[model samples]
Target: MDLFKSFSTLAKAVPLACLAFGAQAETWKYAIEVSQGDIQDLYAQEFKKRIEAKTDGDVKVNIFYGGTLGTSADATELVADGALQFANISLGHLGSFVPEIQLFSIPFILSENNEVNKHLMTDSTTVYQGMEKGFAKTGLRLMSIYSEGEDAWAANRAVRTPEDLNNFKMRILVSPLQVEAFKDLGSSPTPLPFGEVYGALQLKMIDGVGQPISSVYQSNFFEVTDYLISARHQLFTSAIITGDDWFDGLPTERQQLIRDTMTEVTHYMMDEVPRLEQEFLAKILQEKPAMTYISLNEVQRDAFRARAEQTRQKFVQMVGSHGQQVLDGFLAERDRLEQQLN
Candidate 1:
């Protein structure tokens, strides 16, 4: 009586072949915009290998890296329309389609890798079920959420408190929650596509960006920015998504194989991405001795957390009843996990 078992029974009642019109082995395309060396791209490649091997070639996953399929927004559309089989979409970009996913954008909720890893490893938790239920409403099947790391602020200037962030034009993905959160932090957030970020920063179009350590390194943002602030304001989470109808059409065994492979890969990433974060941060500091690293004091950190709680309240109002249900469950689960960890 697990969620997957319930899905399997539902999948059996429908003819998946009716949607794709073939009984032959299926080949799925998983799209991501990062280069191969980036954390997300690496995980996509690993998911592909594990899935195809587990299914013994009965199911094949092909990865389209470097935005071959399109931007993250484009990837979400492709998955929903059933043209793309899978994608690793950021919660910010995903909020446009499913507002409930924006809960992950609530700053300081999962402030450390350990809290994130807790959610990543436990699939049967209330938060996990709530996330799956939320995604189902948007017609996307949620395979799993991978911990990308806590978001830190990278900019051309140092930031130690909310006052230091005044008037900074920060780059953010297309999420209103992000827009509101940064505005609360005293910055003007400019929503931009990830591909244009590098040039924008180089041209002084944006003064900063908030992203995980792996992204700051992999995207070469560290080279352009002069400061790295360990804000750890939000846990950067990404989803492995596919069209619900297409996934339901999949034979139950193939569905199980996909889910199992995702679980394996999630655990692997939980270990690997943190290690990469350390290595990347060290490498960045080693190469650019002039880059400044700022660690916020408790009072400064608390200011951001207070702003985040206010932002979360605004979001609860925005999504109304449905979002409230998920947010309540998520916060409760977060408290339980925090207690367990402490």
Candidate 2:
């Protein structure tokens, strides 16, 4: 049977959907904080539009974007604490609670187009039905997942290989697996909140940052970092979350509306985010003819690939046996979805 089938069965054992079409007189505050004028800001605005239309304004989703709510780790923790109701959390922040989320840090695991929908909606989805039950005690409900392509580097210097990344202190979201991998690369990595990046870079507090080109462009980091290098170093994905107890109180129809709507948003984002990123970057450079875009040689890329495998091994060891099983199932589902994409 397919992974979705398994998910359906699992969801059925939990609660029925399709009973929550009506809107409730509730106010919602969401945090998306990735800065204001970059590529992600555009897509985030679109998502807000959909949510508004879906609820017809009865439910308001206030965006505490650009660190008004908190950074990646704080977003997850606040949602769990119920201090915040909704958030867009990076998977790498899983170090705070779900270390298995680290398995995706396995280098080139998601560099190709084949990885997009691979993990969005399968039985091995981001947070499993039973596993999510654990979050109930913490007061959070893992909601929709949106795919992000592999992350690259934004630096002041040209980086074509992992060796080049050596001694390159970069700012990465605080994750034990990622921190160690960067440390192994001969670079000093300091884990910090996303909100602190701009000032840090401006102050020369760090040397470089590892993120997708889209984010770099969206957050206007290209303004600070003169070089944009496609290291395709790591594949990253994100999860949308809400309070678990709050989610359970919603009617089935309302629940189904979100499930179906976000599924559409997922596909939309998969195509739109990347497409817009290219346009934005092009316009950015065209406007700034003095900027540079570094191209990595094939041999160097392969060297980077070698490091990817080593990183994956580290993740498996770091996450432990139970975490490995989750990784296996997620990869299996990811491979299947890749076939469909191909």
Candidate 3:
């Protein structure tokens, strides 16, 4: 009887002991705008796994997918306001908060070579030195920016040339650069919130959208649009951001762990995205046999490429001297990285 009582007492005391020592884990929220299995979700999952393991479960990450927490803009604002711990926001959506980031929205700004684009995103001083400061002003830390894949245009009709896009009524992100770029490519760009895209397509409110292959398949955009054009005009980029104040308040070791872990995840995403793009494209075709896939040849691509310089100028004009500095630095870094790869 004494032994039974002692064992029961010990078991009851264990809970009190943990409470007394303050051994409770911290739960952090990570908001992503896409559904599970999308690149952002994949990145979040990998980050959650590594961060939990690294911290020995002292910190836990809860991922909110498909705008459950809110839209991309809402989630980003939450992070900036320190109400949310982390979020994965596309540069397209982020342009509203930090307009200079619209630099990435310029068509064909990144290299067609995936390896060069990967290095540019990971190591470019323009991003860390120039764009990072822009993010800081918004009270968010730019953890890392990574590419999902080249943007593929899905339209109601085939788009072999810029002429085909004339008055096509395309759905574009709410970025001035995108609006200008598509206008230059001869489309009537309609900026719609992401959630409204499918209905907009089904209702003919907009003709089509340009998104990564993974996004088209995952979001079921393949079902709504008739053609998937691999224009490769731009790379779909997303930033993993966190609350600046919250991140800065962390201990030095914790901060380093986060930076190191984010770097690792960025590299993994860069490598994994290309493969996933191909896989997703195959799935889109298999599921929607009637949907046509258009791959623009170099000559055909050049037509769209020719219009890019005009939009690039428009970007600098919209952003001003500071934007000019970032754009110049970005192009220089891109050139240097491309040469190094060669």
Structural similarity to truth (TM-score) of each candidate: 0.87, 0.82, 0.92
RMSD (CA, Å), candidate 1 to true, equals 9.9
The per-model lDDT (C-alpha) reads 0.80, 0.67, 0.87
List where candidate 3 sits over 4 angstroms from the true fold.
Answer: 1-16, 19-22
Candidate 1 residue-pair clash tally? 1
lDDT of 3 by residue, 1-342 (tens): 999999999999999998879877889899988888898899999999999999999999999987697777789889988888989888887887778888888888997676787677766788877777778888988888888888888778899999999889988888877889899988999988888898888887888998889999988998999999998888888888899999999999999998898888888888898899999999999999999999999999999999888997888888887777888899998888788887
- In candidate 1, position 290 carries an lDDT of 92
The better-scoring model by TM-score among 1 and 2 is: 1
**lDDT per residue, candidate 1, 1-342, as tens digits?**
699998997787667656556556678988876778888888888987887777677777888886787778788888988999989888787888777777777777663547445563447354456666667777887778777776887898988888888989999888988888888877889998887898988888999988888889888898999999987776678888899989999889878877888888888887787788888889889988999988788888988777777887877887777767766777676667667776
Error of model 2, residue 9, in angstroms: 53
Clashes of each: 1, 11, 0
> What value does the lDDT take at residue 108 in candidate 2?
62
Candidate 1, lDDT over the whole model:
0.80
Kindly list the per-residue Cα lDDT of model 2 for residues 3-47, writing each as its tens digit: 999988978765444435443556666777576755345546666
Error of 3 at 167 (Å): 0.6
TM-score between model 2 and native: 0.82
Worst 10 residues of 2 by lDDT: 114-123
Clashing pairs in 3: none
Q: Which candidate has the highest TM-score of all? A: 3
